[model samples]
Target chain A: MTRFRRPSAPSRLPLPPLAAQAAGFALTRLLRRIARRKPAILSRLGPHGGARFLIDLRDSPLLLLMEPGARRITAHPRRAVPRHDAAIRGRLPAFLAMLHGVEDGDALFFSGELEIAGDTSAVLALRNALDDAELDLTEELAAIPGRPFDGWLRRASGFAARQSGLALSRQEAMR
Target chain B: MMELVCPAGTPAALRAAVDAGAHAVYCGFADETNARNFPGLNFSRPELAEGIAYAAARGVRVLVAINTFPRAGDQAIWHRAVADAHAAGAHAVILADLGLIAHAAEAHPGLRLHLSVQAAAANPDAINLYAEAFGIRRVVLPRVLTVDEIAATNREIEVETEVFVFGGLCVMAEGRCSLSSWATGLSPNMNGVCSPASHVAYAEVGGHNEARLGGLLIHRTPKGAPVPYPTLCKGCFTAPATPSGPAQTGHLFEDPVSLDATELIPKLQKAGVTALKIEGRQRSRAYVAQVVRAFRAAVEAADAGAPMPAGLLAKLTEGQAATTGAYAKTWR
Candidate 1:
C-alpha cells in the first residue's frame, strides 16, 4: 500500500509530468477491463466507415489511438502524428469523468468543453456503443485491483459540489 | 382550468406524469423524430399505442412529438412516424419542420396539429402563418420571449400558445443553434442528439479535474471542486483575447442551471397561455411524478386565487439554481 501527501498546490501544467505515462497504462488496463465486461461497446466502433479515434491528452505523453474493429485499439504511444479518422483532445480527468459517469457527455459538448472533429458518424457510433453498454466507470475503477483510486474520485466529486455554489447563487437569486 | 402538458420519455414516466395530475403528457417514438432522442428512452409503436390507451382511459391526453426535421432523402421514416401517431390515436401530433407539417396536414387532415418550439416562431406573423398554412392548433412558444411579448403575440395569433414553465433552459434560438455540431460533429437537427453521450470524456489532470466534449476542453476545476456537465452553452470557456484585454473564461452563454417558472403561473394565466409545458421527457418517472404533483398543486391554487407556494422545487434543479428564463426579460 502506497500513500502520498495531499496535493497542496494544483499543477499548472495540463497533466502531471510523471503521472501521464503511468496513467496511460492504467487507463489502457482499465479500458480493457471495461471492454471485457461489455464487449458490445467496442462493436459500435468497427463499421463506421473505417474511422480511427485519436485521443490527445495535451501536455502529456499519452496519445491514445483507437482503431475501430482493428485488434488492440489503443496502440499506446507509437510515432509522430497518428493517421486517424477523428481525434478528441483534452486532459486526463475529462476522459475519466466521462467514462465514470461523473459528468454528462452531451452537456460537456454543448459547453464547448469537448471538441469533436473528423467523421461525426464515427463519433456517433462510439457514443452509441457506450450508451448501450451502460457501465458505471467510477464503480469499475474502484474495483480495479492494485489501486485504491476511489479516494480521488470521491474527492473529485466533493470538489464539484462545492464549486457548484449551490447555496450562494440560489440565495443571491432569492435576494 | 388551465391544462398542464407534461413530458414523458418512457411509458412509465408517462403514467407517472398523468397520475401526478398532468392534463396531457407528450411523448415520442424511439427515433430521430423527436427532440429527446436518447438511448433506452422513448416508446415503440406498440408501447405508444398502449400509453395512449392508458392516458385516454384516465381522462388524460397523449401528444406525440414528430418534432425533429425529416431528412431530405429518407422522409418516409418520419412520414411513417406521423402516420403511426395518427393510427395510435394520439390527441395531437406536435410538428416543427414546415415540409413535415405540410405532409401531415395534407395527408392527415383530421389529426390535430401542435407546432413544436423547435420552430422558434417567436412573433405573431410566423405563428399566424403556421396556423393558417398548416391549421396548427397550438404553438409551443420558444424561451426567447418575455411574458409581455408572449401576451402581445397571443393577441395577434389565433392559435393557442403553450409556454414552457419549468425544466432546462436553452439559451440559443431553438432549432437554429449549431454549436453542438460545430464541436461534436453530430447535428441535433439530423441526429436528434445534442452533445451526444458517446463522445464525452472526463479525467483529472494535475491537481484539477477537467471535462471535455467530443475533444475540446470546456471546463476545469480545482481538484475536488464541483464541475458541471459540459453542455457547450453552459460550459465555461476562455473567450478569445479581445482588444486591450486578456482572455476571460466563464459560462459565456448560460449557467449550468435549470428553468423553474413555478412563480409565474398566475402571470402566464393572464397572458392567455393555453397550456403550461414542463420540459423534461428525458427525466425519470419519479422526477416526472414529483414535478407534476408540485405543479398540479401550484396551478390548482392559482385557479382558486390562493397564495403561490415558495421554492417548492428548489432541490430538484441542477446546481439548485433556477431562473424564469426569458419570461423575466433577463440573460440566462
Candidate 2:
C-alpha cells in the first residue's frame, strides 16, 4: 500500500503546560527504571564511543542529553561539542509507548508522530540496542508498586490521559 | 459457507484471531520463508504446534504460509519449512514456487496444498496446471481480478478459490514485480521482505516530511501529517506528461489505501469464492482480533442472506481509507 496522505487532522492535543511537570516526573522515573532494569540497553548506541544525543519531547520545554554507552546518563547535559550525535523528536507519551513496546516506531514515523534527525545509523543502533533487551514496560513499571500493578497502571494512565489530554504520559508516570 | 481466513503475526495474535471467530488462522515460522520477516514476530516450531492445538480445540483450522520463492542454490530451507509444517499438524500449507509444490506433492501426497497468492495464478490454465501437477486443492487468487472475471474463472477451474476480503492491496500482479528489488535489492521472492526497515529513511526537508525507500523518495507529507510506509509502488512520483506544461507529481500508481471488500462480501460469495483472506501477518493482536470479529460477522450475514454491517471496520483501515479494489467490472 502507498500514498496514505492524511487529511489535515487537527493537531494532537498538545501536552498541557501544567502536565509538563508531571511528564518530567514520569520521564525521570522511566529513565531511572530503564537504567536499572536494562542496565546497558543504550551502551552500544554510541558510535566511536562518544555519541551524544538530545531527546526533544514536543510540547514540553524539557531537553534530555545522553551519552550512549557511558555508565552515567546526564539530563540536559552540557555539550562542549555543539552538535549532538542524533536528536529524536516526539511527544513524551509516544517515546514512552515506544520504550514500553506498546507502539511501533515504524508506524509512528510513518504517521509523522515521531522524527529522528542526525546520525541515522546511531538512531538505528539505539533502536536495535533497546529492542534486543526486550524490556517489558508493564512488568518493569510494576516494580514501582507492590502488587496489582496492572490495574493501577491502567487506571493511572487513563486518569493522566484524561487530565492532560495526552496519550499515555500519566501511565508512564509509574515507569 | 465462505471461509474467513485471518493472519497472525504473533502467538497472541493467533489466539486472538481464533477467539474472534476465524475459520482458519494463517501464520508462518519466524524466518525468511514467510513474507513478513519482521523481527520480534512469528512463531517457533513448538509455538506453531501449540497454536494448532488451540485452534483445533476451538474447531478452527490453522494454515501455514511458506509462500516466498526458494533461492536457486538453497531449496532445502523451503523444503524443510513444508516438512516441519506438516509434522506440526497444520491443516494445510500455502505454497508459491513450482518446484517446492512439486516436492511437497511427491513427498507427501496426502497433504493439502493451497497455491499462494504470490503464484499470481490469475487464469484458469495456471490454476488447472497447479491442481493437476501438484494436487493443489485451493488457489489464493491475485488481487487483479474483477468479480465477473473471478466468477468466470471459478467456472473453469476445479480447485477452490480464495480472495482477499480485507487488509493491504498490491496493484502489481503478485509474484512477478521487481520494483522493490530494483530500489532495495530485496524482494518478497528471495528475501521474504518488501520495503525492509533497514533501508527506510524518514527526513524532514523544509516543512514537509519525506519517506524514502533505499534512498528513493516515496512520498512527502506536510509537517506533522501522516506518512505511509515507503512501499515503492505506492509512492508519489513525477511522471512525464503528454504534451503538458509540467510533469505530474503525485501518487502515480495506487494510493496508500487498504483493500476493504466487507461491503462486497455477498457479491464475492455469489461469485463462488470459497474463502476470504485477510492480508496482515505483521499486525498487532488487537488489530487481528478486531478485523476477524468484524469479518466473521460479515461472512455469517452473507451466508444467511442477512443485511451486512455497514462501515464496521472503517477505523481499522489504513489512514481510515478503504476500497473495493479490482472487484467491479468498471475498475477494469
Candidate 3:
C-alpha cells in the first residue's frame, strides 16, 4: 500500500553527557507535556505503564529509557544502556516516522527498518497506546502555555524535515 | 460484481476503509468474543455502533465478527455479542460456533448470518448444511481451496461465497489448529490469539537476532535481516532423526509470507466468489485505507473484464514476499 522507500540516512547524536542529558530532558518534557494534555495515552498502557523501555537509536551514540507510569525518561551512553523490560532499536527517522504516524509500525518492522526485543506485549501495548493517541509532537509543543514561538517552531520543523527527510509531525492519510 | 470487503481494527480504521471504497467492512468487539483480540485494538460497544453508523451513511455494510468458539461454561458472552451486534444495526454477523449460530438464528431470525472462515467450510456440503441449518446467506471460504475447487464448490452451493485475497497466510486449517495453545496455552479459536505477543520474546545472541515464542526458539536471523513474528506455524524447527530420514532443520511447516492474490481477482470472480476479503484487522488505519483503495481499484477492473493490476503492496506484506497459496496449488 504505502512504501517508504527512502533509506534513513544515518545521523549520530553526540555522546557527551551534556548532550545526552539535554536530549533526555527534552524528550522527558515532551512525554510529560503530552501525558498532561492527553491522559488517555498513559491510561491505554494499562498494566504496562510501569515497564521500562530502552529506546536505542542504532546509529546514534545515546539511548533513552522511558517509564510511562512515572512520566519520566532518562538518557545514557550507548555503551551504558540500562536494564529494561523491553528495547526498541531503529534509525532516528524510523522512530520519528512511527511516532508521527507518517509510517506504519508493522510495515517498519516487517521491512527490517526497526527491531524490538523482550516483553513484546509491553511493546505492543505501547504501540497501540500511541496509535490511539494519534500524537503529533509539533501540535503538542505548539500548545505550550507561554510559548509565543509556535509559528517559529512549526516553520523550523518543516525546514528540518525537508532538509533531513525525517517525519517531524503527523502526516495525514498518505495513501 | 465482486464486493470488496475490508478489515478495520479501530473506529478510525473503519471510517478509513469505508472512505477507501469498501463495499463492506468487518470488525470485532474489544473483548475475547472475536478474533484479533489484541490489547488496545478492536471496538468498544459504543465505538462499534458509531462505526456502523459512519459506514452506513456512506452506503457501506458493517459485519460484526463473533467468530471465536464459545467457552464451555460461558456462552452468554458470545450470545450477548450477537444480540448487541444486531441491536447496533449491523448488516450481518459472521459466526463460527454452531450453537452460537443456532442461537442467533432462533433469537434474531431477521439477522443475516455468514459462516466465518474459522468454521473451515470449504465444501459445498458444509456450506449447504450451514445454509439449511442456520440460514447462512454467505460462507467465507477457507484458504485451503484451490480456484478450481472453489468453482466446483460454488456449483452446488446456493449461497454467496467470500474468499481472502490478501494478508497473513495460515498454514493449518483455520479454527482447527492447536499449535498456538501447545506453545502459549492460548489459541485463535478460543483466545483469538496465536503466538500471543505476551508469550513472545526476542534477544540479541552473538550477532544474531533470535525470536522465541513460549521460551522456544522460533528463528534466528543475521542482524538487520527482517525477523518475522514468532508465529508457531511459521516457526523454524528441527525434526528429529527417524529410521527413514535424517534430522532436518528449517522452516518445516511453512515459510513466513503473506498472501497477495490481487492478480487472481478475475479468476476468483469467475469462480463465483461474491466478495474479495482483505485480512489484517490488527493493522492501522493507514494500512486499511491503502489496501482497501488498491483492492477496490483491482476489483473494479476485474468486474469490467480488464487485466488485474500488478502487486503494489509488496512492501506492506510480511517478509516482503507474496504467494498465491492453495489457490494455484503451486507447491502441491
Please give, as one word, the docking class of candidate 1.
Answer: incorrect
Which whole-number lDDT from 0 to 100 does residue B236 have in model 2?
Answer: 84
Please provide, for model 3 over B1-332, each residue's C-alpha lDDT reduced to its tens digit, 9 standing for 90 to 100.
Answer: 79998998877678878988999999999788887888767877888999999998999999999999999999999999999999999999999999999999999999999999999997888899999988999999999889999999999999999999999998678999999999989999999897889999888899998889899999888887888888977888889999999998888777888999998889999888999999988877667878888999999899799888887888778877889988997853
Q: Give DockQ: model 1.
A: 0.04
- State what share of the real interface contacts each candidate retains: 0.01, 0.14, 0.55
lDDT of 1 by residue, A1-175 (tens): 0011223233333455555456656767777787778765654454653567888755345567775454234534424567877777544554444443333444344333455555555665565455334455545665674356767764554465367422111111122
Cα deviation at B75, candidate 1, in Å, is 0.7
Candidate achieving higher lDDT, 1 or 2: 2
- Ranked candidates (DockQ, high to low): 3, 2, 1
Better of 1 and 2 by DockQ: 2
Backbone clashes in model 1: 39
DockQ of each: 0.04, 0.17, 0.59
Candidate 2 lDDT tens digits, B33-52: 98876645677798899999
Best by DockQ: 3
Instruction: Pick the lDDT winner.
Output: 3
